[model samples]
Target: MSYVGRFAPSPSGPLHFGSLVAALGSYFQAKSQHGKWLVRMEDLDPPREMPGASDLILATLEAYHLHWDDEVIYQSQRHHYYQDQIEQWIASKEAYYCQCTRRQIKQSGGFYLGTCRDAALTPEQPCSVRFKVPTAIDHFIDQKHGRIAIPKALADEDFIIKRRDGLYAYNLAVVLDDIEQGVTEVVRGADLIEPTGRQINLYHAMKQPEVSYLHLPLALDEHGNKLSKQNHAPALNNEEPIETLLSAMTFLGFDIDAHITSANLDEIIAWGCQNWSLQQLPNSLASTARF
Candidate 1:
């Protein structure tokens, strides 16, 4: 398959430094290989989404010179797509209804213990649908982090596909859209490494081709906390686009020489496409103290 990648961001807030780092990492990886880079707005949860956040995200990407190949995808508009696949899974017994809450799962040793697996209960208004994780995926190959082992016991637990509020779950939505977009690789932050296994199982259960993974270092604040919207990460200031882009490039372990660093936006990005290497960076997560 021809190389293809994406930078899907939730429209919960404006783009931040961490989001920029992830976007640059994915963009560089795809462009370096002459692949198509797409953008998607994961805006399913209306309660968490901010008004005008999606447009802001697109505008921010444009301002940063991270151009995408095709029209942007919004998750809210694809509810039918997610719902159709979920219904098919339920009919085929690949997934089932789940009524367990977070507190109940936490009481059951952190990970879900499949309490409602055999309930055969009718789907309710406030219930979630859990995917029946097949035992097919034992491990996933991360391009930068190497092989990540998954225990068979963990796969036996049912993971949610739709939430109690009727919103689609990230794992399910992501895998389906990735398949739909033909995403060949997923270059993201190390914070999402833990969900890779479950998503791998989604690929197998959904019978979609698995995409390659390349998790970049998590961008951290001075306090060592991962910078994120929920963590109150400040939005990226488009006023200093060049400085922000250069800093993000350097954070990704690129050797931005003085020539490239001082070049115009388009030139600097062109240089990045020619020289970016996902394999060159250390696999471990690092902090961006200056952020």
Candidate 2:
């Protein structure tokens, strides 16, 4: 299959340095291989979404010249797709209704133990849908990090695919969309490494082809915390797009020449695509001190 990668971001806030790093990394990873790069807005949760954030994110990507191929996907609009999958899983007995709350799970040894797996709870009753994780996927190859092992407990736990509040879970939407988009590889931050194994199981359950994984180093703040919207990391400066882009590129382990300062956005991005290599990236968390 032709290489296809994506950068999916939630619309809870503007794109920050950390998010920019993820976007740039995915963009170059796809472009370097002459592959298609697509963008998807993880706008599944309305309660947390900031008004106008989605448009702002698109503008930021455009300003940085990280133009994506094909029409951008929004998770909220794809609920029917997610719902259809959930129904199929429920019907096929691959997934079941779960009424266990976070407190219930927390009080009962943290990870969900499938308490409601055979409860026979109906849709009319308040309940979420949880996938009955099949045979555990203990490990998967990470293009950047090599073979990473997952704890068996995590791999075996039945996880939620739909929340009782009626919102489709992140894992559910992401897997379905990636499969729908025919994503050949997933190039995102290392922060998501924990969910990879479960997502792999989801692919197997859906009987869809799995994609390669390349997790980029997470960008950390001076305090050593991962820079993120929740942590109030400042948004990317659109006025100095080149400087910002260069900073992100260097963070991804690119060797930027002083002369490159005179280059335009397209030239800088072309240079990035030409020089992109996962081997050059730092295998640890990247500090945002350069920013």
Query: Candidate 2 has what TM-score?
Result: 0.98
Put down candidate 2 lDDT per residue, 200-280, tens digits, no spaces. Answer: 989999888888999888898888899989999999987789988888888999989887889999999998999899889
Candidate 1 per-residue lDDT over residues 1-291, each given as its tens digit: 799999999999999999998999999899989899999999888999999999999999999889999889998999999999998988998889988889988888888887888899786546899988767466778897788766666656677889988888998889889999999999988888767888888887767778899888888888889899999998998777998888888888887788986799999999988988867676677666454
The candidate scoring highest on TM-score is: 2
Instruction: List the global CA lDDT of all models.
Output: 0.86, 0.91
Q: What is the lDDT of residue 258 in candidate 2?
A: 82
Error at 213, model 1, angstroms: 0.5
Q: Each model's TM-score?
A: 0.95, 0.98
Candidate 2 displacement at residue 19 in angstroms: 0.7
How many angstroms is residue 97 displaced in model 2 relative to the true structure, after the best TM-score fit?
A: 0.4
Superposed on all Cα atoms, the candidates' RMSDs to the truth, in angstroms, are 1.6, 1.0
